[model samples]
Target: MKPLHLERCLRTVEADKAVLCSAARVPYYPLVVKKARGSWVEDADGNRYIDFLASAAAVNVGHCHPRVVEAVREQAEAFMSYTAVYMYHEPLVCLSEALCRITPGNFPKRVIYGLSGSDANDGAIKLARWTTGRSKIVAFQRSYHGSTYGALSLSSLSLPMRRRMGPFLPEVYHFPYPDTFRPPFSGTDEEIADYHLDLIRRAFADYIPGEEVAAVIIEPIQGDAGILVPPVSFMKGLRSLCNDHGILLIAEEVQQGFGRTGKWFGIEHFGIVPDAVILGKALGSGLPLSAIVAREDLMADWDAPAHCFTHAGNAVCCAAAYASVQVIEEEGLIARSEEMGNYLMERFRALQDSYPLIGDVRGKGLSIGVDLVKDGKTRERHGEAAAKICYQAWQKGLLLSFFSGSVLRIQPPLVITREEADRALEIIEEAMRDFLAGRISDEVLKTVKGW
Candidate 1:
């Protein structure tokens, strides 16, 4: 391993702590990044590591991709940005058309732009409410939409995120998200689907009537909640339920879009098309951009200046986003995601045979999660092991994060090569061995508090 020279990195972190607010931070390691290229990152201390988190799955095409960089450079040279609300730009119009065309939906679609997933999601909620004239919104338990007030009201994933921050948008309701591995119900996947669907049905019948609910927003694969992949039956059932009640179904693809889930969108895996698809993260190839593609008629009534922002659809960001989409298409990264995902999961399954702590390995495409358990029969969560493994992996030149205190988040960029993947697996296996042998200590775990 390259010796860690922490003087520069520590200095940077201390400087950041002096000025930056803690509310905007969720740091897992102290490694300060100086530069990143493709699937690798160089820390301020000059240590190189393979980046498996891929900047929280926002760099699906890999960091600093040539096309994305070139697009940004070209757009910046032409002009920086003007308020898109009043003016028209080629990059904005082109990207809007591209998103409407690629996202799942046969109807005429319109696009709304924003600077982050939270804002786009907030816009979606407003659009749903405006279109249906309903006051209530439905979301799943342990699902994280965003941090903005409207999105935060829809999120129930992190307690820390919601603590002391209430009177969250009234009329918002949350239901259980059917997690197949640690399922709420004791039966099979189909049974679990039925159980959650019944809860919604009963809610509509008794308390929150479906007619009052404007929309049901969900992540096709719950990212922050440990990469939970609900049964196909559950997604289809939810879609049908929304249809029966005239409730708009919004697919939150913030972390799972742009070829991260093997398909263009994660909802495509379940064979269902959402009324509105939220796109962010990988959509902009590291630029600040997010959007929602919905039916044209749904947004026809709500015209400009309603949910507009000053820098929502900046031209340079739109150029980077369009280039990112083109790279995913031309390079066949979507198919590559599937092939590499299968390879990585197969390796993990083999590793699980030797390591009993691994309770479950689940996900689609590059967005996989490895759940660590205390016991095979009881399947109790082993968050400590997850933390130690991540720390050890970092020590050995691999970078990743864990979620819900137990599951190891394994979402690497789609551009990762087989050789690089094998190396990362080796690092993880080494970390696992170290943890099992009591090589990693609690002193190290104290350095990071993972959510």
Candidate 2:
């Protein structure tokens, strides 16, 4: 593919296409991708990039993973789609069993399927409300679940995401989620925990009664909201409160599940078992598939056609998801993620020593973020600077993404080797240093901002 072909593709997109919305936070970097494998992606002009963003984390097992491709291809040959809502499907049952074996919870559990994170979230929350017979729900500020109406109502990540999408689900309340680097409330970890926990306790009296709240939905590692990770104390506080009030707890792991966070689930790091877990993105290794795994009693009563998606439980996707699980386990990608994440963070912190603009480097496992700021003390969000880093990174054959503005997000595929991690990190450091030395162009800086 030539540069002209790439330019033509870009023009065709703008002229012939109309997009209702998007979650990608950076300006579109124009390089028509031709193929990808493992952690490397080749664009139209044959420029290869270390895929740090991993296609919004959908291909965690790596692009065109042989096992996943084989599974989907084999399933497609026999049958493509099946309505599990009506008849039996072996792949669906096998995938359910696999998830049941992996997902937390000692009691009897069941799996409910959907086509995306948003729909799974809706199903999980609806189940919580129905089973518990409560109406109100609680979500955190700067949290993102999905784009659908019910999930959007619970999302506090972006006001633009909810703008003009009026009359969202009632009683969907929001509270500030704690962050270590940003420090939403100033103090030590204990003090931070106490301050945020007190707010939740007060919400019962001031905002909405705790008794009326059906569930408290949260991401163990906040994804779209700059990869924010709350303190363990805060997580335990929520768990205790849920237990005390008989409210259900649902952990939305759409972005953080399936070894993306070094563990089977991000919630595992916190050492608390949620009543339900929402999974998507990497489950089918690039295919669209999401599921809500919960206690048997909670989901055993959800009858079919009550909540139906025509493509839900598609045989090929289920087969792919099952293979993805096997591939992750057989290949030891989970352990690899843990090892590479620590190495990546260490490299980032080393880079931070030379770059003051890199104010904070924090993450567990592969979901890491480098928060750029004007100054360490003032902590003014330098979104432009971060975007400039992304601009330079793309030019240097590295795909980087950021959200909201300040935090440079790095969610590479789990199958990425130390060599790939080092390559991407070197590009990141090189890009940052170049930007600092005034090598970044004014046009690039201008376009990277206010997107």
Candidate 3:
């Protein structure tokens, strides 16, 4: 079959049989992408899309970046795999050294590699438990760490992601996320911070002992749930609380790391150094690589052989990650992300002024989110409406992701130019306007909407 025909056939079959995620069958603009380069993807239908989603925040330096491609190619030609067990390779060592240099804090650090965000979180959990000789873990509600059993247990999202997946790994606890837009504590940022910290203190008194709590894992800037940026004092308070309780703080930077949030690591923005940092997604520029970087002393407890994986430090993946980091650093992508983020936020605020449905617009760097509501006063979630906006954007040759039902997340590649960003914003505005004007029927719009 011809490629286009093949894609159509595959999509048709997938629609019928695939038990897909909420966004999967929502009128896919084009079923297949033939190639991608420099912030755009060409579909099998001969249409091009500006990749605002960046393959769900993996292609930070742009899709198929030349340096990363070259690194992968070079490693593949020479050697593809080396067991981290018997022998060592240059790529793994160099990548670890580079990570030490870039990760926050002045303390000596150690690195552990994994294949994806889920595995990285798994490794982090083990490291925390082993180092502390404790079993309890604390996470926040509506936070998404990963989907594996271990990571999923640590995550506190709604059902199907965790429902009937129990009895989940025991002793994992959840706290309310610090959402300023919809404060779970019902007060100002400072009051919210105090309330959250008090809740943690109460948790120690009522549930897990503070000394037995392995770690308090959090996303510096919550993704998936929404681009929820906690107040600076809230984060610092959490850090201080962790220190006081003698619990390790693990910052999950899986989505917000690697210049996505205009910082080397999202935790850096809060000026707090976590005991361990979980990184993935953009680390390998779309290749599968994730890591746990922590203080050398903390990781030393995992000296035994049982803690390692067979493909822990795959050379090709490490090489790709090293090259991706180099591009982000040498090209000044962090600063660029900050600048583009500010420009996009400004545009979003302008949209907010004109559209009452835009209840919130918040984030840092290239990661931004617009939460839709029926009315700003009520803040009733317009999940269906947000999904329609995303579908319309996709139809207009711009790809974005929907999160937490009502949030339309805009996370373009760091390599996205100001011109490209403007074009994307234009498409978003057109979609929002069309949806608001009732140009599309409620039935069609509802089909695209997930609510």
- The candidate maximizing TM-score is 1
Q: How would you encode candidate 3's per-residue C-alpha lDDT over 1-451 as one tens digit per residue?
A: 0222345535754675566565334343334667899989877656677898898899999999999999999999999998886789999999999999999889999998888899898888888888898999999999888878789888876676776668878888999888889876467888987787788889789877888898999998999888999989889998988898789999999999999999998999999999889999998888888999999999776776745777877999999999998999999999999999999999999989998989999999999989999988778888777877777777777887688889988899999988888899898888889888876455645345341
lDDT of 1 by residue, 61-119 (tens): 99999999999999999988998988899999999989988999899999988989998
Q: Report the number of the highest-lDDT candidate.
A: 1
- Can you give the lDDT of residue 24 in candidate 3? 35
Error of 3 at 194 (Å): 1.1
Can you tell me which runs of candidate 2 are displaced by over 4 Å?
1-26, 445-451
Give the Å error, residue 205, model 3: 2.4
Error of 2 at 184 (Å): 3.8
For residues 50-163, could you state the per-residue lDDT of candidate 2 as single tens digits?
999888888989999998889988999999997887788899999999999999888889988999999998887788788888998889998888888999988987767788
| Clash pairs (backbone) in predicted model 2 | none
TM-score (C-alpha) between model 3 and the true structure: 0.94
- The lDDT, on a scale of 0 to 1, for candidate 3 is 0.85
Question: How far is each candidate from the true structure, as Cα RMSD in Å?
Answer: 1.0, 2.4, 3.2
**Model 2, TM vs. native:** 0.95
Q: Which of 1 and 2 is ahead in TM-score?
A: 1
The deviation in Å at residue 397 for candidate 2 is 0.6
Q: Candidate 1's C-alpha lDDT?
A: 0.92
Cα-based lDDT at residue 393, candidate 3: 76
